[model samples]
Target chain A: MTNENNSLAEKKTPPIYPVKTKVQVSIIFFVILGIYLFSMFWTQKEMVGGFSGAFENMFTVMEKFFPPNFGVIGAIWGPLVETIQMAIIATTIAAILTVPLAVLAARNVTTFKPLYYTTRTVLNILRTIPDLVLAVIFVGLFGIGLFPGILALVVFSLGILAKLISETIEAVDMNPLEAMRASGGNVYQVIWYALVPQVLPQFTSLVLYVFEINIRASVVLGFVGAGGIGLILNQQLGFYNYPNAMMIIVLIFAVVIIIEYISTKLREALI
Target chain B: METYSLPPKPKNSLYKKLKMIIITLLVIALYVWTFVSIDIDWGRAIERAANNFQRVIPKLFSPDWTATGEVALSMLETVFIAFAGSLMAAILAVPLAFLAAHNMMGGKIFSTIGKWILSAVRAFPDLILAILFVVAVGPNAFAGVLAIAIGSTGMLGKMFSEIIESIDMEVVQAMEANGANKIQILFYAVMPQIIPEFLSFAIYRFEVDIRASSILGIVGAGGIGTMIIFASNNRNWNEMGTILLAIIIVVTIIDFASSRIRNKIV
Candidate 1:
């Protein structure tokens, strides 16, 4: 009986993690660690005094930004409004343009495989390009002004809005659409009667979300000479006017928080 | 045919009608203000496009193959900055995530403070942070890494906390009933549930960090953006073309690989 019990215990004992999984996890962990070590070494090579020196200088450097000049608030108000206007204009244009592109990209709505695939591919490629890069190019083309900034924002927001709205289109309940088709409705009539109502709330929510992103983006577009509060901020920093830069930064932070709060409330009410 | 008019359209309440009219009027006023206030030099823009369009568009297509090596090196630096930054953020966010997670924290106040800190950190764009770090660190790849690290931490912390909150608590309770200590319960019950998602989100953040770090160079924080600014200033469209190509290819590849890994991990 003792021998039989010993054999049963030996046979029943199992490892907490399968041997294969253990090996894989360890290997992955080590590989990631190795990559991280290499990256740190490479990046640190370019530093003048490395992390230690930077840490020592950080406090003193930060001190230069304090006692922010509230005087600039009056000066910056104009560009601040320009920044907000840029976002609003871009969001509006993008929202209107996204409808058709979204429909073409949605597989269930478009149904034509070639058209859907082409639109999807174009949008994917478009998204891969950073908004800053787009702004830079348009500034080159349009000679550094609000036009380039607005154009960049419009293009950037279009990619995101189309992708989001298309996904919402794809997930809609098909029963109503099918019923409309059965009632002898044409394609346009069916889409208008069945699809629009279902997607309107979500579309509005997504557009609001994109508008928040646009607001953040438009603030930075001025860095590349695209025109807005960022242009003034950049100039102040260039002049080594840390106090004014600090003021601008504070203003940007407050505006961003306020706008985001309002947009979030609107989206919550929407969806 | 029976002279039966369609059922009378339902009348909206007075409040609803007023609300609709107010919204419409506000929208129209907004557009009117925007168009009138925005100062656009359409004439200059049209003129510039006519002259520069031919010169720029052609060169953009025919990239300077000679600049590929320089562009590739800078692109590699951008990747390294992103990787190091994202990894640091992943580790740094752990304690904050636990602090913010309502279930993990002992007091609601701590969680609320944690949440506020995360959002505040998130409010500053990576570029803005890069500018500050560049001043402190004297404009190097390390500055880029620091900016990316801090910028990513806010997002990662929030996501990790959400993951923690969504975890099944019954297992933790069972561990407690079995006389397990806090540390034991965390390791044996909680970590197993959250680890996969944490790693997945960290990897995804790495992808975003790459794109972000690429532009940090604009402020001299280090990466491809420095090259871009130089190229644009000199009107070197061919070089800009190569840089653009490199960004698109690298971003696309990283996004693909990261998504695949995230799928497997989660």
Candidate 2:
């Protein structure tokens, strides 16, 4: 009877707050805060030479990009088209290649654990390096041209497209695949009739996403003399031809918006 | 149920069809044409790559351990820049995301404006933004951080808004049905479901930010990337090799750690 009364009293009491855990969390936040403050001061000191002068001249620099030169539009059209084409070609090639690579990489599809991991690791490392860096290296290897840009895009987009598509494959219904296998369907047939149907929408959407990224990346690649509007933009910037640079920037902005809108709509429709 | 019987399958494959054959041939021809147009000189490229490897391979093995201190200091800045930038973006993105969510905003105008802002910011690649900021902010790490923050806001806002749109509306409705205010409902109901996704995306963005910050130094925004470009310009392969080694090590370590954290969060 006394034990039962004590248990009832214990249940009625409110639980105490964990003050130590709160303190620990606070300590972590403070430490991070301190580090951030220290880095800010250090960077400020290091950048002393050019730092203050930049802000002072900001107004003058802003003047240059204004009232963008509309006349330079015609001149940039060809290179702009070249840039779009490069992206299209790269996206197509990468999308096709990614299919086989993605299939071989997906753990459920491949069943070869080691091969799956190795391919996945390759894709991860490939994705880490910036597309611009790849273009720069390829340009050095192959000489300055569009070829290097396309190659870089192919390699870069392949990494992204493969990873995304492989994940989609992993998320697919396993029952359908099992049924296909039980019926003695070959690997190709299983993929075509069962796996492909399930993942096709995601694949197309991912391809389009990669294409958008490739377009932006290709423009930058052109800056390193890889042959696109970026090459022209870089030249103008190099010569301090602000008017021409302004025009290129405007055109780029417009093109990017249109492409993004179209791709976004398509993706929405697919999904 | 009645069982249906079919005729025996054809011996020939689907590729034997005239339309399929034509389509395949056309695709191959188009690819070949693009390949040729791109002017990829396989032989010359192979030779040059071989020569580059010969120069790079030996130097890549050796790192300047003494310079590790300086590199570490710079790396701290890179990390802080990424952290601070993403934090800033996360803070800014919350309100923008709320406004951008169609279900929440109940108006197309605001969402359209939000989306336009996002796309405009995104259209200018981080590299270009870094360049512009470097020019504006004087080649400082502050510029790097701010540029990343501005660019990141675009992506974060878009993604966060989408996450909001996809959330189960019942929970939100329940909160609204109660005496809770907008802020209270947001905090108590909408946030819990979206927190994991938000954290996952933020951490992934941080990883990208690290890589982005590394490259910003190339445009004079200040980091070890400046060292790589310097070494490259001076033809100091040994120094470049050391920088590359440092980068590969640091990046790989961070990449591993962040993904682990992200995995736990999601």
Candidate 3:
């Protein structure tokens, strides 16, 4: 390499690549990699059956779930509808509530530094709480019913919806809002006529996306007696009714796939 | 000639105005119907909502500090499970990702099959996957690990395949022209380009798996989620507050720390 660059040496040839930086980069990489590998090894040793044992167990388990009991589907229809209803109601509330919070949280919309920081911090903490814990807490608070499930879904989806909408607001082509303001439009008029149009598409798309998340979340919330299809599934499991549990799983799976398909199509159309 | 001044805004046409009102009404009706259909004790819920605020928020400030040790240990267990799961997914997803990518797979049938499998696996959420594993392995942390790995595979494989499909074909063509073997081309051409992105995706999945494994406990698969259930069951709102606070703190710390590391890599 030195020989090839000799002719340009007197003219101050730059190094082809920064050897110093490359070494530093790899050193950092290896250190992180080392910690990650050690953690994996420790966890594997502490838990999990061996690979061969798991394979054997997997096969045995396969037999238990085979030809899943479809008979239980009829019994679960009411609870399944309850789960869907929980998602729909929660999503509507979250979408409606996100409008003001998202606007205030957005740096572009709110120049109040303290407000942005406070809102951001609160949202982060909200997002950090696992949805399961939220469900369990709500269940305990309000007693077991669809209300707690709906409430949990509201808070859970709010964290997601607010974050997404705020980012969307920030990324909007600021020109339209600016144009309206320049035209002497009041704040409400500017937002409604200019900013709303720009973000309407994404806002709708994100609401549909959050609705999908809420459906799955509501099912899990039911496991903790929060009230939905998962409650029945958990009851069956606790009673050692594998076939019934299998049936519930299948029904939920079908619903998830159908919802996912519809949402995907809707999202694509929005774009 | 004087420049024309901006015209006053025109009112929305009656048809458009009526259409807007109809849409708004329809949405409100749907929301109301969904709310009313559920069998809920709204009176109790509203009553408890106020009681819960009085009962819960105060406890959060005085978090039962004694439970911190137990909570932290289980939080570590959750992180360990997530680590193991993410690594497993990273290893398991590569070949499947290659098979799924149309640009790499070459055959429509193979890629279609791969895509279908990914979609099927992705349909089940981690908590549901945890339930299946609990039944399989009798509710150990290992079950949580397996569940997380399987869940992560579906997503990581799909994202990986997408990245592979969008990669520059020119480098691959050059390598093939040089008479490189399949493995040689994969390593010398494809791997170099996608490795950074794959790492980022895997790391991101690990962060997500941490949040997921914590909740896997509700179904008896493993982790701190069971702590919340237990605390709630015993009507120990203070203990529940402690558990929740621990989770929030731990998860936020990890999110920030991991994101910083990610920035260095990508």
lDDT of 3 at A33: 73
- DockQ for all models, in order? 0.72, 0.38, 0.51
DockQ score of the complex predicted as candidate 3: 0.51
Stretches of candidate 3 off by over 4 Å are: A1-51, B1-33, B49-55, B177-179
Which 10 successive residues of model 3 chain B have the least lDDT summed?
A: B53-62
RMSD of each: 3.5, 6.4, 4.9
- Sorted by lDDT (best first), the order is 1, 3, 2
Q: Note the B-chain TM-score for every model.
A: 0.92, 0.82, 0.87
Best by TM-score: 1
Reference-based lDDT, residue A80, model 1? 95
Per model, kept true contacts as a fraction are 0.62, 0.42, 0.60
Ranking by TM-score: 1, 3, 2
Would you list the clashing residue pairs of candidate 1?
Answer: none
| Fnat of candidate 2 | 0.42
lDDT of 1 by residue, A99-177 (tens): 9999999999788899999999999878878888999888888898998999999999999999999999999999999
- Supply the TM-score for candidate 3: 0.88
Q: Interface RMSD (Å), each candidate?
A: 0.9, 2.8, 2.4
